[model samples]
Target: MKVIAVANQKGGCGKTTTAINLAACLGKKEQRVLLLDLDPQGHCSLGFGVFNEDARDLYDVFTGEAVLEDIILPDVFTGVDVVPATKTLQAAENLPVRRDERDRLLAKYLMPIRDRYDYVVIDCPPSMGLLCFNALAAADLVLIPIEMSLFGMHGIDRMYDVVRELRERHGRDIPVRVLPTLVDSRTRLCRQFLREIGERFADDVLPVMVQFTVRLKEAARQGLPVIAFDPTSTVAVQYGRLANETMSMLQDDAATDGVGEPATGLPEATAAVQHNNPANEAVPVLQSHATPGGMEESRKRLGTMKRVFEEARSRLSRQGGLQKVVLRFYDFTGRDVKLAGSFNDWRPDQGVVTRTANGIVEKIVMLMPGTYQYRLVVDGLWQEDPSNPEQVSNYSGGYNSVLQVEEEHATEHA
Candidate 1:
């Protein structure tokens, strides 16, 4: 079985969410999946509505009080079995195993039942401890979920350093792929950060991005994967795409003898995987929905998402009386210019209106009297307003054009 460890030392990066949903989506593809919760917080089990204060966990397995299969919670979701975690699992970090063998303990235990499942998805803890080390040492692939923020991208260098160390010690290469989570595509800041990630990580970044939505929170509250809670939601579609991409990646790795180069694009076709289980059918996974012949399908699925975000922005904009503030760009005459700022919740398409004249572009936004931070999207790229001298740090190693509006002259151009 291929083991995918969803790992990140940073918290609030959607690490557990990716693990639970990815497992559920993989199970939907008719693959036998084992969801292993290694986090002491036990949030993965909690996400699945199976968190029990008293349960046989990985700690028991590590201590030799129980075997791996003995604690399996079978069929939590279709074709998915869960090895749930409790708070006591924290004790496993202090197990008295020899230093060299501690890191390989998980890999050793997984060997016996490796053939029973097609995949083992491990939800790692948020710290670089023995548990996290065990997960990484045992991982065939490390899926890192990066939240779209400055702090979210922090400590990733440290993670890569650890991965390099493990690779050298294990004498095998473990491929890593970054999945951008909680993406809000409508915002210039988010879009800019996404571009920055692409430039920085390049081929290591996956094509599929998980969009920010309240429905995911609701699903977690209801103890169900987004698929089971709302099968038709856009987030669900994204997770489904992630599963397809992951399978295609594993297939590619298998084809190359577990040392394939980083995937830059979707595979044109997939070869079916043969399983050891007699009853299990051969796996013929497809590329992510949007990357293949499903462009129109993706557009249809995202329609609801767009409408929901627009309606929410409309409601928020209506909360206070708005005054017109004209912003001028003298340099970009023929280029397409749009405005995104704090006044419109950073969404480029929300409250900003644009007009072009002789060698100048004017963007007018309606806002209540207050200070605002804004950016110009010139021909699909983000930059601070050159005409505006005032600026503030965006905390993502960049600056934002700052504007101050008062009730006395709210109608005047800045």
Candidate 2:
């Protein structure tokens, strides 16, 4: 199984949001996903509408009160399962290891049963403590979610430095992905920061950007992922796209590191892995999702990618409140045309592209003056707008047409 840890020392960077939504979306894709909540706040457990006041948290498993298997809440959402965290886990800060190996606690427990799922995503706390160390030790990839703010880069630089230091000290080598979170592209600052981040991280920066939305908060408050709360929302679609990109990253990692890279730092366990206790032996044999030699090619393609963001285009004028632009599809003869993009939560069904009198697929999208990215679901095949010259990579191995909505005054004045 591929393991990912969503971590950031600074809180409110969409770390938990990314972890929760990505897991839920991956589960919806028929992948067996396991979410491990290591944060003391228990936000993940609460977000999923799951409550276990008397249930065992990760603390119990670490203290030997319960095995990891006994605590897994299976089928929490479709194909997803969870290992919830309680407020009691805050005590991990003071917990001491029997030996000097403080970081091996989580790796020891996860080693046995990790093979049961396709992905094991850990939601880490907002500090650099034993909990974060444990997650770092167990993860194959470290996803650093950054909010779209001026201070975003500084935090990422610090986190990246921490990961590098940890790898050197503990001998664990894990990949890191910089994901831009809660982006508001209407502002020039947001656009500039995205361009700067992509330039700074190169291939390490994920192509997907999670936009800021009230629906995400509403979904969390309602005890469900945004996708579950409102699948028609663009934020849901972005999370789904993030999941696929993450899966692709792992599939690539597996091909590059064939024998499957062991959980770094724990030497004895890695050597004696085949001889785990009988009870834990029932855990199925681990298998990789990537074919041999595929990761190298994927890596090359990823590394060669430049931060070519789509520049928006304005063809039509705006009305009072919302800018109205008629999207015209010249070559589509499909039965249905659905427009899904940054604007409409990637729900093609919500905004249907009609066949106009001009003998082509056409539809009017009334959006506030701003920039957005979208694609047409023509006969279920996702296609970029053919007539639109401005397009950019979606970072999940696809393209999205960039659109700019300007107010009538702005258009007329220009």
- TM-score of each candidate? 0.63, 0.62
lDDT of 2 by residue, 1-414 (tens): 877899976557788898999999999989999999998788888889997777788999988999999999999997889999988887775676754466668877876775788888899986666788778767778899977753344345556766775566666566787788879988775776676566456556666778899999999999899899999898998888888778876876562221143445632211111221212222121111223235575465334322222122121122154455677766656467788865555677564435455557677665555456678887889988777786554323356677766645332111
Q: Best candidate, lDDT-wise?
A: 1
Residue-level lDDT of model 1, residues 245-319, one tens digit each, is 788777666632221222343232222332122222222111122333365754654454345445544654574
Question: What are the per-model numbers of colliding residue pairs?
Answer: 0, 2
| Candidate 2 lDDT score relative to the true structure | 0.70
Best by TM-score: 1
Error of 1 at 310 (Å): 29
Candidate 2 Cα outliers beyond 4 Å, as residue runs: 98-100, 170-172, 255-414
Question: CA lDDT, every prediction?
Answer: 0.74, 0.70
